[model samples]
Target: MEKVINAALCFDGNETQKTEWLDAIFSDVDRHYGYSNSFEKAIETTAGLMPQAFLNRVFQGTEEQQNRRSFFIRHGGIRRSPLSKIDVTDLIAWCQQRNTPEIWGLVASGIMLWEKADANENGYFLTTSAVTFLEAAPDPEPVLHAYADRVTPSGWTGSRADTMQPRADAIAELSLHVRQDISDAARSTSNRLAMEIERERIRDRQRDEDREQRFE
Candidate 1:
């Protein structure tokens, strides 16, 4: 399953080939899992298993770092460029102006910090740890509030904080859902495999008994 997902990720095929590969994978998953809904859920589950650090390395790393990664090197060497060339300060400014939570969440998830700064400090950057934690958290509100409290100036509460908070919360909520779906699918697969093993064991036992009776 991991191999299939990795192949999809590493596939350097053109649009038609990419679509074909994806369709084939989706068909196989549907056949095996007997899912009524689209196979996109299964794909999302597979993506949930990916390490946060790996995501950072892929999307945020320097050119040399990207080149060193085996998967990228094998898959035609990092085709998409990093989203931004700007430093953390510039990124924060850009995000502030855009005021988009999705973009903020993307920055939180993808950006890697060269130097850690106090949340209180001017031009403070979001750390990879904070972003990953928020994404995986089942209840992201508390964490988001805590994060906001830490970064926001004392006695300051306004529209900016309100807007940013919900956006971050939304990102975390979406991540939590994906993780849950992945967990459920994994459990379902494990149970199916277990049942197959048990059936095989019973069949083996029954065959042995029949042979013994025949010999007797």
Candidate 2:
């Protein structure tokens, strides 16, 4: 998944300069997944559906935070047994086992700051670009559905869809998560701003009252 994200980065970036991301992805996948699974092929497989922006955000944290994210991504975003869900203690313990003793608070903050999952809290269902490396992806069969309308004054109206592909399902799940995250952030920010505005208004009223008392 990291390799796939890095390959997505490769698509976004200019080839002129050296980058750490491109470096790591190329080194690991070719050596492991064989030359058949080239980065280009990976990107092509995940073209329109990849949550490129959200996956990039996963790498935007501190070095230690990035390590935590790496583990989460590798596990396909499942917070397995004993953990129940993505809890702070579980992540810290996991990191400790790997000898990555980054501050527990920092790890906790990372989880809260970036975590988004289903309503059931079952999985952090973003950036599941699994088709790249996996030889046998869930339900490889492509289910296509198409609709066409008669052309009137408004030219032609038609659409194509891969109705049921594992990759498409992954992408749709990601879109829902991203949308909910954005909505929640916007609501939280707006609420905070409103509270601040009300606080300022109360302060202004108190200041006016105090001035009147002084004048009297």
Q: Write down the RMSD of candidate 1 (Cα, Å).
A: 21.3
Best by lDDT: 1
lDDT of 1 by residue, 1-216 (tens): 546665665545455664554445434433443222334433433334323322333333355443333222122112221222224444455455555454454444323322234455323334555555455444444434444333322343333343233323323333334566533533443344345445645666787789899999
Alpha carbon lDDT of each predicted model:
0.40, 0.33
For residues 1-216, could you state the per-residue lDDT of candidate 2 as single tens digits?
A: 546554554465453332454334433433342122334433322322333332343355566555544443332222221112243344434444444323322222223222235665423322221212111111111100000000011222221121112222333332222445433433443344345445645666787789899999
Candidate 1, residue 167: lDDT: 28
**Each candidate: RMSD to true structure?**
21.3, 20.2
Q: Model 1 misses residue 13 by how many Å?
A: 1.5
Q: How far does residue 61 in candidate 1 sit from its true spot (Å)?
A: 31
Q: Considering summed lDDT, which 10 consecutive residues are worst modelled in model 1? A: 72-81
